[model samples]
Target: METLLSIIFIYIFVENFVLHRFFGICPFLGVSRKMETAIGMSMAVIFVMTMATLVTWLLYTFVLIPFNLGYLQIVTFILVIASLVQLVETVLRKISPTLYQGLGIFLPLITTNCAVLAVTLLAVRLEFAFIESIVFALAASVGFSLALIIMAGIRERLEMANMPDVLQGSAVTLITAGILSIAFLGFQGMLSL
Candidate 1:
């Protein structure tokens, strides 16, 4: 139980895929201009990451290892993740046109998002249990969402604050992300398995 809690803490605060590991910076910066868009993307990511983890884990444990096909992990993982993204895109388009429009090109971009791929690959490499991998992926997705929402909130405020001409737009966003990453690192020694 302690190990589980530690994994949650580390993934959410210590090893956040965005602010800490820096996996999905493209959408982190591009789609975070609005709180709604950020939230939508986050929800979509959480769903995709968790689903991808589940599918990949089942495939690896049941099929790949059984047939000495371990070498095909990456290819198989990508196929699963891409299909999940497409399903998510379809659902979002039908359920919420506003969010669908807000997400724009970024929706399909999730297929190529490194964070999703990283979570799937890491879950297999780390040899997590069925439930453990689900939890890990969930924690990572929440961390990504937390980071994105925090950045969106900050950017909203930064828009209102006075700043020099040179430090506008992505310049300020990058600087803020740097500081946020350092803040996450401060969690060092806070939790350990």
Candidate 2:
């Protein structure tokens, strides 16, 4: 139980996929201009990442290892992740057209989101149990959502702020992301326990 809690804490505050590990920056920047879109993308990511972890773990354990197919992990993981992303895209388009449109290209780009792939691959490489893999994926996705939402909120505010041309747009966004990454570094000590 304590180990699980530690995993949760470390993933969320210390080794966040977006803010710390630096995965999934494409959607992190693209869909974060609005809180609504950011939240939507985050939800999709959480669902996809969790589902991908479940499927990939099962496949690796039950099929790949048994068949000496460990060499196919990357290709297998990509197929699983891509399939999950398609499911998310279809569902989101049906239930929330506005958000579907708001997400734009970034929605499809989730198929290539390194964070999702990283979670699945990491779970196998770390030799996590089924439950542990699920927990880790959930924690990582939640951390990603937290980072995206925070960035959206800050960007929304910055839209109205007076700024020099040099610091506008992507420049400021990158700088803000750097600062956020630095702030996340403060959580490093908590992991020592």
Candidate 3:
């Protein structure tokens, strides 16, 4: 329990997906112009990432490991994540049209989000146990969402603030992300579990 808690804390604040891992920067910069879009993207990512981690972990352990085909991890994980994103899209469309609309085009884009793939790969590389893998996945997703939402909020406010011509859009955003990453680094030694 302590280890799981520590992992969650580290993933969320210390080793955040965006700040630390630098995965999924495309959407982190592209889709974070609006808070609503950011929230929707974050939620979709969280759901897809958690499910993808679980499915990939099972496949890697039971199927690939049994066959000694671990070298195929990347290809196999991508296929699983793609299929899972499709399934989630279909289910959301049928069950919640509002959410489908809110998610907009980003829902499908989840297929290519490196953060999800990175989380699965990290779990495998670390050889996390079943529960630990799930916790890590969930924590990573939460961290991604936190960073996305915060960036969106800041961007929303930045629209009204004066900015230098050269550092207006992507330039300033990247700088802000760098600052946030430095801030997150402060949490590194907070917990040693």
Candidate 4:
């Protein structure tokens, strides 16, 4: 169980897909202008990533590897991720137009979000067990959300705060993300994972 906990902690803090792995920076910056949009995108990512991990692991473990079809992982993974994103987009549009609208392009962008693909690839590459892969994906999603929400909050405040001209817009957002990434590094050596 400690290993599972370590995996969660590793993905969530020690090696966050956004801050540590540096994946999915596009939506991390593009849609993080508002807390609502950020939350919406994050939730979408969480579901998409977790589902992608589960499906990819199942296919790789039982079907692909068993059939000696390991070479098809990339193509299959992309297809699965894209389908999942489309399903999510449809559900969000029907269930809550507000959030759907807030998500905007970022919703569909999850299809191309390397973080989703990264989790699946890494899970297979590391040869993690099914449960371990699921846990890792969940933790990575949470970490992604943590970063997005934090950036949204910071950007929200920055909008009202008086700052230098150069520090406005993406400039300040990128700087804030860099600082947050460094702050996450403080967790280095905090765990044995």
Candidate 5:
């Protein structure tokens, strides 16, 4: 429907979790050094974000609110996110040792990624229906993946470009991220969602 399309567009381009809201900056910068690693991290993030959204939304709606235990929202959400990250870690370790190793600390760091937590909390706070929550989470994750891949590609190219010593390394990366953020900001008002 038009509403779903608006949700997807608004989250991906306008209110992007990474570029716009500035969540998950650690992995956004760390794993983005290589396209392969960025893709790996993005997949893990997408899985975790989507699953977390589903579980948390269900618990909040069916358990927490019904039981008048809404005060435990943050605690419950973190536990769900952390457990999901562990599942992802185990699966990645068994499936692709290279990516698992490449991700290193960043993979575990996804457990604490505010973006993951934010999506779940946002879905609940916005009172989104079950399907809307899934769509929102998927859109957010795709947006995050898009930003990560773009940053990785840019960083990879930047490694080859001749640049000043001052603007090299993290300096250039931060500058590039800022520029990308500004570009995403231009999407504002493009959609009313």
Candidate 6:
């Protein structure tokens, strides 16, 4: 339970997908302009990240380890993540047309999101147990959602602010991300595990 809590806190604040680890910056910057779209993208990301972690963990433990083919972790994990995203896209479109429409282009773009891949790799690197990996993955996705939501809120406000031309768009977003990263760095000493 303590480890699970630690994973939750770590992923949400300490090792945030965008601020600290710098994963999925493309969508983090591009898709975060509107709160609605941001929420949709975040949801898709959370689903894909969690599923990718489970499938990748299973492949690592059952397939890769058994075959002594750990070297194929990256390739196998990427393939699994890509396929999982596609499957999720199809399922969501079939079951939830509203959500499918809301997510729009971001759903397909998740295939290349580094955060999805990073969580899988980090789970293996940490050698988390099967349950622990799932917990970690879910926690990580929650963290990503938290960050995206917060960023979208900020950007929504920023859109109304009259900023200089040089500090517009990606420039301002990057600066905000940098500040958020610095804030997240404060959590580094919070947990030993």
Superposed model 4: Cα runs more than 4 Å off: 91-106
Task: Write one digit per residue (lDDT tens) for candidate 1, span 57-115.
Answer: 99999999999999999999999888877877888799988777765456677898899
- Per-residue lDDT of 86 in model 6: 80
lDDT of 5 by residue, 1-193 (tens): 7888999999999998899888888888888999988887888788789989999999999999999999999999999899878887888789988767865456687887889999999999988899999999999999999999999999999999998999988888999999999989899988965
For all candidates in order, the CA lDDT equals 0.88, 0.88, 0.91, 0.89, 0.89, 0.87
Taking the candidates one at a time, how many backbone clashes does each contain? 0, 0, 0, 0, 0, 0
Deviating ranges (above 4 Å) for candidate 3? none
TM-score of 3: 0.95
Question: Per-residue lDDT of 145-171 in model 2, one digit per residue for the tens?
Answer: 999999999999999999999899888
lDDT of 4 by residue, 81-134 (tens): 988788778887899887778665576788888899999999999989999999
TM-score of each: 0.90, 0.90, 0.95, 0.90, 0.90, 0.94
Estimate, for each residue in 85-170, the C-alpha lDDT of model 3 and write its tens digit.
98888898999898888775787899889999999999999989999999999999999999999999999988888988999999
Task: Give lDDT for model 5.
Answer: 0.89
On a 0 to 1 TM-score scale, where does candidate 2 land against the true structure?
A: 0.90
lDDT string for model 6 (13-81, tens) is 888778877888888888889998889888888888888998999989999999999999999999999
For model 6, the run of ten residues with the poorest summed lDDT: 99-108
Clashing pairs in 3: none
Clashing pairs in 5: none
